[model samples]
Target: MKFLKIILATAIVLCIVLVATDYWISHKAEGYLYSKVADIPKNKVGLLLGTSKYIATGGINPYYTYRIDAAVALFKAGKIDYILISGDNSHISYNEPDTFKKDLVKRGIPENKIVLDYAGFRTLDSVIRAKKVFGQYSMTIISQKFHNQRAIYIAKNFDIDAIAFNAKDVTNRYGLKTRLREYLARSKAFMDIVFNVGPKFLGEKIPIG
Candidate 1:
């Protein structure tokens, strides 16, 4: 009985520690990013994060749609001169960068002004490569608030000045799962930063200017 009690106490403490750590990291990031467009500082480039257009149920993914819309808004407002669409292109058929490129063009962003990073398989890759590969020291990031905060945290670690332009958030059932997952992601991001985790791939330098 004593052993079981000790195990239960340890598990409870671990859970509380995890929750507190996630909350603290998230709060730190929230202070740096601009949730509103009027407050966002202009940068030469905007980093558009990628998500699949279609969910497993074949319904349109709200996150994908909202991110593209936010990127378009930033461009039309003249708040950003160029856009870097970053995402996974792990397989021939699963090209996230091209998907964002096609959608952004259709939304009226000129093709020449759009750059694609096909190797942004993870948020860490996208944020780090935005500096290392694309040569962008400062840029606006477009994504949902939770995601933007995490990305901004990563950017701050690498001395990249990044602000977020929040996309319209989905508040439905789907959003709940994502929000929960974000806690775990934030915890992992803290560990990644502590360990100085680099991107999985860093090819030759690709200048955006």
Candidate 2:
């Protein structure tokens, strides 16, 4: 009975510690992203995070639509001069950067003002490479608020002056799942920073000039 009690106590303590750490990390990142367009400062480049246009249910992904919308608003408002679409392109058939470029162009954004990072397989990769590979020291990040917070955390670690312009967020069950997953992601972000994890692939420097 005593052993069981001790085990229960340990588990409870672990849960409490995890929840508190997750909250702290998110709180630290909140100050760097803005939901309102008027609050964000102008930057030469906007790092538009990538997501699949279609969900598993054979429907268009709301996350993808909202992010593109946010990126468009930023460009039209003159808050950002260029956009850098970054995402996983490990497989030729599933190219996120290409998909984003097509949608952005269809929205009347000139193809010349957009750049693609085909090797940005993850958020950490995108944020770090934005500085090391793309030569962008400061830029705006576009994604949902939860995602943007985590990206901003990674940016701070790399000494990149990054801020996020939040895209519209889905508020249903799907959004809840994303928000919950973000807690675990926040913890992983801390570990990645401490261990100094670098991007999987950073080819020849691609200056955004």
Candidate 3:
């Protein structure tokens, strides 16, 4: 009976901690998120965070489409001179950065204007690599609002001047699952900051002009 009570108490405390951490991260990123193209400040590079183009059900992922749209809009508006595609290339078949580049090209963005970082496996990697690997201390991050919030928080901790262009969000059943997962992700991000965790790969510097 005592063990059962202890387990319950522990679970409750963990839930509280998770919620608190989530709030802290979102609050920290409040002023850094932008939903309109005209309202956002210009930056030399726009960091296009990567995700799978298709979801598990083989449908086009709204998150991917929206991010690409956001990137294109930013470029056309003269808000950013270059688009930095950062994402995972873990498996031979999976190439997030390349996929994004191709789509951006198809959308009429010149190839030279888009640079790829094939090592952004996590949000932390994407944020850190933007500064360490790509020589960008200030950038406009592109993703959904929830994702942008977390990314902005990470950027602030790393001393990067970063703001986010919020892509249109998915609000279906899948979106609900993603939102729930974000709670745990926010907690993990907080711990990553506390522990001074760095990117998994920091290769030779690639200057972006």
Better of 1 and 2 by lDDT: 2
Cα lDDT of model 3 overall? 0.96
Estimate, for each residue in 142-190, the C-alpha lDDT of model 1 and write its tens digit.
Answer: 8998898889889988999888888999999999999988878887888
Expressed as tens digits, the lDDT of each residue in 85-202 for candidate 2 is: 9998998799999999999999989999999999888899999999999999999999998888889888988899999999999999988888878777877778898899999987
Best by lDDT: 3
Identify the superior model by lDDT, candidate 1 or candidate 3: 3
Candidates' C-alpha lDDT: 0.90, 0.91, 0.96
Q: Which of the numbered candidates is closest to the native, going by highest TM-score?
A: 3
Give the count of colliding residue pairs in each prediction. 0, 0, 0
Model 1 residue 6 CA deviation in Å: 4.8
Question: Could you arrange the candidates by lDDT from highest to lowest?
Answer: 3, 2, 1
Candidate 3 per-residue C-alpha lDDT over 1-209 given as tens digits, one digit per residue, 9 for 90 to 100: 99999999999999999999999999999989999999999999999999999999999999999999999999999999999999999999999999999999999999999999999999999999999999999999999999999999999999999999999999999999999999999999999999999999999999987
Better of 1 and 2 by TM-score: 1
Worst 10 residues of 2 by lDDT: 17-26
Which rank order by TM-score, best down to worst? 3, 1, 2
Off by over 4 Å in 1: 2-7
